[model samples]
Target: MSDFSRLRHCMVDAIARRGVKNARVLEAMRVVPRERFVSEAMAEFAYQDAPLPINEDQTISQPYIVAAMIEAAEVKATDIVLEVGAGSGYAAAVISRIAERVYSIERHETLARAAIKRLEDLEYGNAKIIIGDGTRGLSEHAPFDAIIVAAGAPVIPEALKEQLAIGGRLVIPVGDDQRQRLCKVIRRDATSYEMIELEAVMFVPLIGEHGWAEDGSRAASNHKVGASKKQSLPAMIAEAAENLPDFEDPGFGALFDRFADRRVILLGEASHGTAEFYRARAAITRHLVTRHGFTIIAVEADWPDAAAIDRFIRHRPSDQQQEPPFQRFPSWMWRNVEIRALTEWLHKHNSRIEEMEGRAGFYGLDIYNMSGSIGAVLDYLDRVDPEAARIARERYGCLTPWQKNPATYGRAALSRGYAECEKAVIEQCQMLLRQKLNYAGKDSDAFLDAVQNARLIASAERYYRIMYYGGSESWNLRDTHMFETLQHLLEAKGSHAKAIVWAHNSHIGDARFTDMGAARDELNIGQYCRQSFGDDAALIGFGTHSGTVAAADDWDGDMQVMRVNPSRSDSYERLFHDCGKVRFLLDLSPGKREPLRRLLSRPRLERFIGVIYRPQTELQSHYIQAILADQFDAYVWFDETQAVTPLGPEHHRGMPETYPFGE
Candidate 1:
């Protein structure tokens, strides 16, 4: 037999040897073309007991491992299964032959499309591929009888475990890349599970909203397919962001400046560790509102938490209520006067005011306690219908964040909206339980198994929707409301609307601005502004101090920005000799000028600007290191800096003036 044929035989032989006695699973494995899923170069070794690299840095799972996991699941023809990390959809296609239906999720768009094509070409009609965060799982078709994870994780993702049907099995590789254990977990009942170790295995790290941190690393380079020379940084960044549309980028700042006169700027500082950044956030907010006539203060507080203050605002509280519970001071009442404190002198004022520049006047959006956010929305629904609150909590466990919350459900009711969804799910659960009563005489244990499985599938279906789309609606609703509120305000005053959103740097950077290989397709605010407001919006990202100022105490008022260059000769040679390597020349600020010049003059200045020319992919790791105060630079990021760090140094790439900033 040919090597490929022999390996395929080996997989089937090993599976049978390992006690994978299912005839259907073995038949499915024999017919499926594993060679088509890997790269053209690796076709000769397709059936080997090792993962093969494919396009977009993904891998087709090893043949024996795939066969073994499939066999372990004990799938039947009537079973519905879920496959996470559906690379090229080869394994899913295999599962489709032995199961009623298969739902798979892939985070990378490239892999998702490729997998879809492979399945379609193979005529796997019962399999579906979704391009979204796999950590969230597929909700539209929930309660799968089995789920298999192809990637390794640092921890057992709770969301995935919740989606399994009662009596369903979940097989996943859990641990870091170097060391991992394949774990098969069975849901014994609600609030209980049985886990068994299968074997040790190695796999690529999972990256997405719920998996490991997609920390914008060198890891993305592993996906290299065909490359002549390294692409330009700008082209790489734009392509990565455009390819991945989840995170927002603020690269479209120039487009937004047109609406500068109209945008309402909101600011916040929530985390106690990064509270100082709020001072900068507030200072910018105050500068805009005071100088530009922008009005509106929104605090990130629960309305129910703030309603007592609202009663105080209207002077409706009883006389014996000496002070509002949320208030830090009794004298600081009214709006614009205290608003300046939050916007201008945030660091010196109360953390709440320093963090939140809005004083709840003309408009506001609250996101403090997520449960409170649900409650606030529920209060609105309750005013519309008294029973809405009770149904929401009992049926959907709709009060808190979806990842850890509880639920109630059925199959068809799974497609409805929140209120209707609750009624449908509860009714379905009852119907399934009723069916169990008819079969109780056969085996009491089996009858209870059906009841438990029915509820399991129902609950997973309900919880899946909440995780996939419900939590997302909270922010989407806020933005939609903001848009409507702005429209109303503009209509009333005969004015235009402008908005400045204060969110993480992830929300603002234009992915188009970064190298595609750096962050591997993250969406940011800049992308949304372009899509949402089009040419009318500007997105400016604040990123410099975020990675550098490690802790509250590391910074002093007298700190200056420092510029340095990496001493690696390869980078120097690339800058001076190579035509392909791009250089990112930056002009230093007044704060950075002196420190940079002094460091450049010293031969052993590693004590200050220890590392320079940091690989753009390592930015997030640097960010975490900076955040933890583990002893790192003042700032390390991919784009936007006070001092210049070149991809490769070329003096001509630097700005015209030697000393651009006046001392």
Candidate 2:
């Protein structure tokens, strides 16, 4: 066979390995000629089991994902299929091999025209490409045996569903833009449809009248309130702010009562060093713990360092007393006056309650500490079981040479000169987990911490190693680790236990609605929590129109009180500022006002200031396009804000601004 033919067979085999059982789907993929559907520059990578950019910022679905969707649809030789968001006509071409006819819709006229020529050149006689909104399926080809939507939808379009023939299947990616689950809706009878969730997949947004608007401009226009009459935004904002309860008002607690049943509440900060964001989150958390029975306060801090604060808050004796937690770079993030006050309150609250039930615990959900986590695992094991500690020490000894600088290990591991430590770390973690019951009676919490640390050591090892081979994979790995930690925390705390998450907006906000998410293929804790807990997880984001923020121009630079530029005229912050409230919250729940929905659904610039802040390049580095209403269930806006105050003397001065250390 030719090279391209061999590659095609390999791609089909890979799809089959992913559990695509339909023989027809596999055969169709095998004969599709994927190279013909992608740009000439990308043809070399056509057989790779991943999405490739086509035209108009669109992507040809991964071969495996396409096979999975087709298999789920259960297309037959006599069937007619309707394919939506047909960028390159690749998926439709594959469907044509299995179905009698395929009607593909592309909103981009250029792409549709190109796809038609490509399909005709390839002689895919059964397939036809049309230029129009895919959400409104081609009505001329009325009842299709199957409908496959290549792009994600906020809600499954009624038009597409109506176009499905009785006993037909509709396979689509359903959910918000950040992430979606592959869903198959089978028309059981004329009046009923059976839905099954297949798996998670990410795709470009479907843009049309029934989907997301073509661009932020179009989105803004569609959702613009009272377009004919120009009303002052600041005046409207001021009026709205008048209705919000005071920060300390007991009545504000009622606003959160709706979320009392939720298992997780992820609170996001648009900028890490904003005082109002921290204070507001603390106030909300105090209420959740005191009245709503929240039992955990997890933040975006490294595990070993945050463990010190956890010990202090739980009133457990610890070696961390001599030094506070958060000694890492950007120490001011958690070692600030605002966080100190919150921790002090947690200590007092936990002290007043019994050890078992009512006392809430503090934990860290980040995995940046490679050596610290390993040391923690070994230290815990030594106290619980010396022999097990000896075994762990021996297993981890393979990594001791590079413990002082884990990146050295990351580099060395990639070369043949160094031995692979992954197996050793995995074995150590597995042994710890397997022996959990043996050490449970001695100290359950300690044992749990040790096991979690062991797991962290294993994950951190892989994370560091992957960071060396740069890509968004490292980002995804970190967030996945955080999500797993949250899950473990909930499982250990008990089924009814609720928690509050404190993380940067990038980590806590749903990534789908932002440009960063599309570029990196990143998924944050907010997206995962939403998918896992659905309505039982509430994501709240905090923002400020303009304020003084504590940040540095570069990593490891001295923290300075920086002036935050005012929000852009086209940004969400501007809208909030115009609302005229000094401080207020807006609920974006499904049943909220249509005006609010319209305002939020429109894409607008959202600021995201991290540890490193550079005002000169703020637009490129700190701003992202986001549909605020779709990104979060609610938003808390501080019209003006001040910087957070650091709690103690800075110790990170003169630290080398080197790789794997500053980030």
Candidate 3:
């Protein structure tokens, strides 16, 4: 295949994985020659999953957006479609490949003429262009089977709604210029219609009688609530955000000194597999551990898995395992080179400390290892008391059948009513708590570890039993467990204990300020920590505009090194990108950047790349509406970043293959 053809086919495949399952839409997008629609200078980026600037100060909507809109419109092969804002004529061409007749309208006469010339040259005879106000739509074409608008509107236009044929779909972005929602309006009858918000989007304002006035809509919609009129968002960020030196620089460590006094410091990552996030967080943690006496490094990982690493780092004895920790799918999230280096450094730091409780410690706050946690609890009880071990086994055995695939238990429990073991696990945890004094007298650390394992079992049991039905409440359970685990560790370590939490932005940022809380009613660890600890907790979030990330397409899928799409125009990451700084830190505390914080308090998009990333459907799948200033106290930005270096089994811990247990 030719280079363009190969790229086009790859783009189609990527979009398929991104959740666009419409065969007609995929084929239409695949057949269209997007490279010919834009200027020669922009040809290379034609197939990229991003909008490229075109003539008349307009943009060609990204390939995925066009396909998604077309799919949303449900354009049939015999359908007559209308496209508004035919910038570069790309969307019209794609629609023409599927629809029988296509009428595209543009306000700019030059763009309309250019689109017509390209359509004729490409022999797309079914597609035609006309000069008109797109927001008002093509009235002469009236009653189109489908209508697609490529610009943002303050509200759905009456004319466009009226032009939709019965049972036809009109897909458009409706909101202010800075942000909008891709809405699907289906005309059920002459006077009745159904509206569905598909996803968040950002588009140039549709300029016409039915759209915005001659001037732009941003200033009028946004007023001077934050920064003065003279300073734009990017300029304000550039002035407010602190430009930090490289990770190696001592000054870089000094930049985090302001957080030294905080009891709990949560460091977030833009993605699970970004090397820069890992390296930067590790550097900050190292500085805090060595200079500021921070004792704990808690993370979003399975409890049993993290326990192994914690033992290794703190010079404590651990049960010898057949394989290393984090061997499960997406193992690279914790079993990568950057994390390895951090563990080694923490181990060395702990070795220097004579006070056992004061030494740096590593721990996990997640609850995903029911099997391992069960084994740990049983082994501990067996060593301490045979009778308790037997009782524990009997109680935990109620859940043994579903331990490997706990999701089945949730469904089975619901279908088979009395199958859940909630009472048994709860009793087990209470039993451990009641015997805490008796166990502590023997070996406090071991007793605490065993009790925590039991607590995790109880939480995991509930997590699996309710996960299938709990929806957002289950997510709440997980985060609540993590927050409680952090509290447990702090309580166990004594009053002077300090902690540094390492997790993704979704877990570390205050969820109340994001769609997670506002739309779904989910609370995360950061929100809980802030409410419980107040000013003692510092929630820091992270972001990256573009580059690459090591992620999987689905849960338990093999990892792939995928290119990160450029941040959406409405995201804080994009605003940071426009600041022209490769990396910086924005401190939005009480006095640092009052104007910047106020500007950021307004809702905007924020990307959350977990172990999975879908670039094609990114806006729908990953980006969440967030008030950045309220979500986090400090924001770290990297304009571009590279994927983490995942370690092979032989290279575990950068040690020799002979050392299966690792360096």
Candidate 4:
């Protein structure tokens, strides 16, 4: 096979691996000569899956996205298809291979002429290019079997919908100019239609009667902006954001050498479920562990869930009957493929070392799993002292009633007759501390585990009770617990302990620089670490412009791999996207015009996606005000990313049926 043919097959194979299972769609992509549409200089990149810049500032869609759209449209050999905004004619060429005929429309006459010539030269007589407004869609050909739009439109054009044949599929990107989702609309009947949102996509504005204006007056898409958004900022950021090699590349670890000496390195993710964020954090963490001697790996997870992982990683024997890690809702956060790889690597690394203290330990810093912690404490005490176990069981019995739904206890406490159980949980924790010296000598690990569980129960009790009151009290208490937990973990490892934290950007970015602290007085672990560790803490945040994310529509809901709307035009993620590199690491540490400080002086809206994502109210739910220059020491950028591969429920071994209180 020729070079282009080999590259085309490779691209087809990659798209197939990413879940595009349609054999005809894969074959259509494989047979198309993508290199022929672009100029000779750009031919080398023609077969790459990434979108490539084409004529008139337009971008040819990524090969994977094109394949995905075609597969979603479900085109057939005898079908007649319509393609809007055929910039390079590549997608139309691929479609022509599978469909009987293809009619492509383009608003730009120059692009239309070029596409016509390319199609004719390649003997793709089945495809025809027309110079006209694509939004009007070619009414001459009354109805099309499948219509695919390249650019993002403000809304589904009525004319295009009217032109779809009965049972025809129309795939278009619909949303504001800054963010859009690829939606497949099917004409069910004369007036009925079915719309299914596929994934998030970013494309140049579809400029016509039904789309954005010519001057960008209708652009920006209701974005939140700062004082001055000089166009130079994005370019300056792109220049300063250092390019990074693939995560597994040796050079990728060297990029983090500047932060190797910090006592605490907090790696953050814009959303809980992007694969790149987890993989990137893992790479830097491995570098810190192997090259810099960082021994503690703490995360935003429950103590009991992570304890199971800790034992597995540190080569400590555990009861065969013990529950597996991450059994609750949103279990995919820690039970994903990327995390599984990290744990496997850590376990191997720890096994190579003989001293237990010298090996890196994985731990959770969040306050959840009160019932699990109670069970673990009782189990620990039972093995050491049966008397203490009985007393602990009695003390924790007060909380057994609310084990299924601890939030109800908070409401119960607010009522006139109910009493708070805070005192009982604390007294039990204090007793455990008092006997620490006596029990620790027997097995330091066992005593520490039991004591931490006791401590967790006390904190969780107060957390649940105050959560009902709302405001920042509960938020502050949670962060305090996390910070205190980190301190205890570090202290247990000695003054030489160097820790790495994995959490959402909201929990790791310095809240002082954002409205979280300034407006609501909501303290987070990032702010606490900065106050405690001072210059010894390095906070790095990760963000993406457009991609897929694993999220749920509601709390405690089933996980769905949903589309992450592109960054709002006025958000920091947009600026990073404009930087033009597919991915990079931008140093935002304070200095004299260093780390692009001048370019980032103004405050901008930053996107923060947690476990739950409600796209309908994304601006209000996800965006926050923050001065990026001070919010983090560095920012890792990925122009586009995909959702994490979530493990099946089989991974979650055993858990109490009433293990509620999942925060």
Candidate 5:
């Protein structure tokens, strides 16, 4: 056989050895051209079962791991499979042949772009590549038939569980850094799931948003392939807490100072659409920027808006100049809370924006119409055909077509005459509108007129500065626009200058941690920035406090909130509940407070019954009167020792339950 055939046979054998038996998966693997997905130098090893290094420190998953995961998932030909790691797009391409649709994510720009090309070249039309975090999963495309994690994680993430379709199976390596076992968890029903251990395997640690941290990754590597869960949560927490770096402590203020007397770039989370969040983020960004010589501010708005910002900087009229505009800004209904808040904030800040320009001409980091450039097209379409415009508006307005919905409005537009040449009038109107919206807002005649009157430097700047933000999709364009904006800042604004990126967490969090079987597998701005700046770039995830409710008004305030009662992880049948308070033990040392533990290993009582304590009622002063009436486990508290111990599963039916067990 030829070299290619030999490699294919070797790959198949490796996959079989891994216990992957699905015929469809094997055939898909057999037929797909892996060599095309890799570089020429490594084409010889394309069919190897090992991961090959790719650009940006990313690697394609080993072929056996990929096949085992796909087979374990039982991906049906009709099922829409969500592939979390689209490193080389080889796995996605193979799955594309077996699954109805493949939504793959990659955080590295080089990998994402490469995957897009490889998949496209092979005519994998069923596949769509998105550049976003996958750890959160594609909530918009909730109910995926299968989800395959390309990397190993310390635990099965909560977000992925929520995103799984009913009865869907998720194949992932779930364990500590020391030892990880392939765990296949099936969502048995809405409220429950069944877990089955598959086999032992190893792979690169998943690094994205919810993946193991560097410490956790290190811990995993220290253990053997299969280690038992031997440590308790409190012990582990204490160990991790004690071993953390000094920078994690309050004394690390000096490091912040060392970074610079330069400027404070306070970033806010804009992932959720609540206007309160954006306002909070903007206010924080402004306060920090203003306090620290941050004359030039930036946002994810369009280039035209950026230009308008420049005009504001130069004290020029904005109404007549159409180039710098808020074309991508959504003006539709108020259903999309995030978009609504963003638009309102954009409008309300016009005066503040003017002030910012006066301070130091704030630039729209996203100078091109990126994510919603199509929204600009639709806005222009409205002027030409009002009826068709209404349909398009309804198409996107009612549903967040930008999400991972099966029937996206953009896809529909492509199917209809909307994307064809037959709609010449509409198409021309859109083209002209986009041109005006994205550029300096001049017509053919006006542009020439301005050119004839402008200085050489001005004309050259306009020509050099003019940029486009469109690519694979609206979302993808938005990211590319930010990257370009960063480029412009590094080149145009000057190097060593600081700039803040205002985008979703998906764009900010490390891709290795965040992007996975997600709706869109696009490169995050953080990933790009890190590649460019190395340790100079840092990603701080804005995570919500679990078991607490944060109100909208609390954005600007600080409050110590209560946490859910703590519970042990081992026993599931305990009647113990979270008391939602921090108990202080009298005998404990200043630095060593014992974590409260449950008295029993399992639930001994059939059920817990309670009664209202009233002044007039019998046994009102007896805290355990009911428990004394019915024999039950007695809890004795020693005030001096600051300790509580369980008495017993005893019966004292007719008496007030007394603290029989004493110090």
Candidate 6:
């Protein structure tokens, strides 16, 4: 078979695995000649699952995403479909095979003209391409059975909804320009519409009278203001402020009581090493465990390392044998004063609870410890069943040479120099799971840990292998593992068990409202929790306008006290700083305040600092456009903050080496 034909089959198979169950959609994908849609120079890459640049700086949508959006619209054989942002006419061709007729609108005249000829050449008789602003629905072709918009919009255009027939589905991305949620609006009646957010998507800005402006510079220019005429900070403070001096304040308990019934409470940090963010999370977590009966504290740390902290907190005998946790890169993240205080509090709290009644536990939700997990699985088996341990050792022996650096093994596996040990790892995990009931009668916790470790080995192997290949798939795998780990912990703890998740805002905030999701097709624990538990999950985000943060200039570099840059004039942090409140909580639940709600919906820059910080590229590296009110359920803002104090002796005492001030 030809290479393109083979690639076509592979693409269809991959989409099917991603949960596109429509046979008709699958068939259409198989039959479509994607090579015909692109220029001859790019024809070889047509079958790849990524968006390729086409005429007029536009791109063809990724194959899986196109199928997903089409499936979301639920087009029928007799229905007429309207597709906005029909770049290269590829998506319209796919839809035409599923629907009776497809009317596609493209904002770029050059792209529209090219797409028209390509569609005609490919004999897509039912598909029509027109040049116009896609944000304005084709009113001449009124009452479309399904309207699928391919660009991000500030809000769902009323004109598009008006064009949808009764009981019709309109699949569009709704949010700010940088990031948006794939929202499916079903016309329930003449005046009522039901909106369901599917996943996060990033697309070019839809420019028109009803959408963003044509030049794409309006958002920045409109929000920017001179110092004397800046929006009133005091007015916003007075309208929305709820003072939070400390986590122990009575107000915090009352605030937390509002989410007393939630199964998961995800706390987010704007930066990983902000002292206030860590303290705030610790305080809230203490209340959740002591008063609200939350049973687990799962963090963004790796599993094996966090298991050590978990043992220490639970006062398990295994703690004596385990090495200190958080010894890896970014060790200060969990091995700091803030986390130490929380772990001590957890130990004290667990002391008062009965073992069976369920003492609160600490766990990790990252997949960076492939070799450590493998060792952990073997260690557990040796203690319980030496015979089984021997078998596991032999099975995992193939990976022994690369134990110090598992990524080397991943590279070897991907290059086909060494075979993948996926089957062996799976079999080991299955063996542990199959004997769960037998082991539960003796040492249930040990058995559970061993099974989880075995599973982590399998997942981490796949994760590292994919990471080497370079794409967004590895990120999805890691987050999926974390979400699954959270689920398992919840199940093991009991149905009533609640969890407090600690992670960066990027991972804890709903990705649909953040640029990370739009650009990388990433999903985090927060999105998974929201999807699974709905309103039963509460996500709280923390931010500061300017602060001292503990971070390294490069990965694995020495930790230092880094100066955080001030929020941009048009950023969300500046808005909060303008409020003139030193520290306050803003509730962002639906139906809170109409004026504040409207203000928060407008896109503004938000800061995100990971373990590594480079001041020179701060704007490009750290800032993302987001609608504040949509990103979190409640936001805790500290106008000025300080760096977290590290626990070890390697901490640096001077200002960061590359401070930008006076440069």
Q: How many clashes in candidate 3?
A: 0
Task: After the best TM-score superposition of candidate 5, give how far the Cα of residue 271 lies from its true spot, in angstroms.
Answer: 3.5
Which scores better on lDDT, 2 or 6? 6
Badly placed stretches (over 4 Å) of model 1 are 1-7, 14-21, 216-663
TM-score per candidate, chains pooled: 0.34, 0.66, 0.69, 0.64, 0.36, 0.69
lDDT of each: 0.46, 0.79, 0.84, 0.83, 0.47, 0.81
Q: How displaced is residue 375 in candidate 6, in Å?
A: 2.3
Q: Which ten residues in a row have the lowest lDDT in candidate 1?
A: 624-633
* Reference-based lDDT, residue 64, model 4: 79
1-663: candidate 5 lDDT, tens digit per residue: 777876787678656654778999998898888888777766866775555656664567667777878988989988987877788899999889899998987766778898999888888999988777666678787788898888778777777877778989888887544345788889988889888998755455666667754433323235332221254433322332211112223322222232234322323231232233343344434443444434445554444344443444334444341432432222111113333333333344444544433343345544223223334434434544566556545433432332232123334544442331223323333434354543334333223112111111122122222211111134444555566555555453345456655554445544432211011234556656656765565443221112322121222232222221222222111111222112111111112322311212111111110111112121111111011101111111111111111112342234222211111
Clashes of each: 35, 7, 0, 0, 34, 2
Return whichever of 4 and 5 wins on lDDT. Answer: 4
Give the alpha carbon lDDT tens digit for every residue of 397-486 in model 2.
Answer: 988887767777878877646777899999998898888789877887777778778878888888878775544567888999999999
Candidate 1 per-residue lDDT, tens place, 410-455, comes to 2223454444344544553475455454545554432332333333
After superposition of all CA atoms, the RMSD between model 2 and the true structure is 8.6
Candidate 6 wrongly placed segments (more than 4 Å): 1-234, 248-250, 649-663
Assess the local accuracy of residue 165 in candidate 6 as a C-alpha lDDT between 0 and 100: 96
Can you give the lDDT of residue 103 in candidate 2?
93
Q: Find the 10 residues in a row with the least total lDDT in model 6.
A: 654-663
Question: Could you tell me the TM-score of candidate 3?
Answer: 0.69
Candidate 6 lDDT by residue in tens digits, 1-663: 887887888788878876899999999999898998887777866876666667565568888889999999998899999999989889999999899999999888888888999898888999999888777799999899999998877788898999999999999987764357899999988999999999877676777767777544334225422231243544754568788866667566566677778999999999989999998888888777777888889999888887876765676655344555676788888788788777767777777776744788888888887777887888888777899999999989877877778888888887876878888888888898988887776777777678788878888878867776544588789889999999998888788889999999988888767655654467888888899999999999999999799999998799999999998776788888888888877888888775566667655668899999987667556777666777788898899999998875443235232211101
Best by lDDT: 3
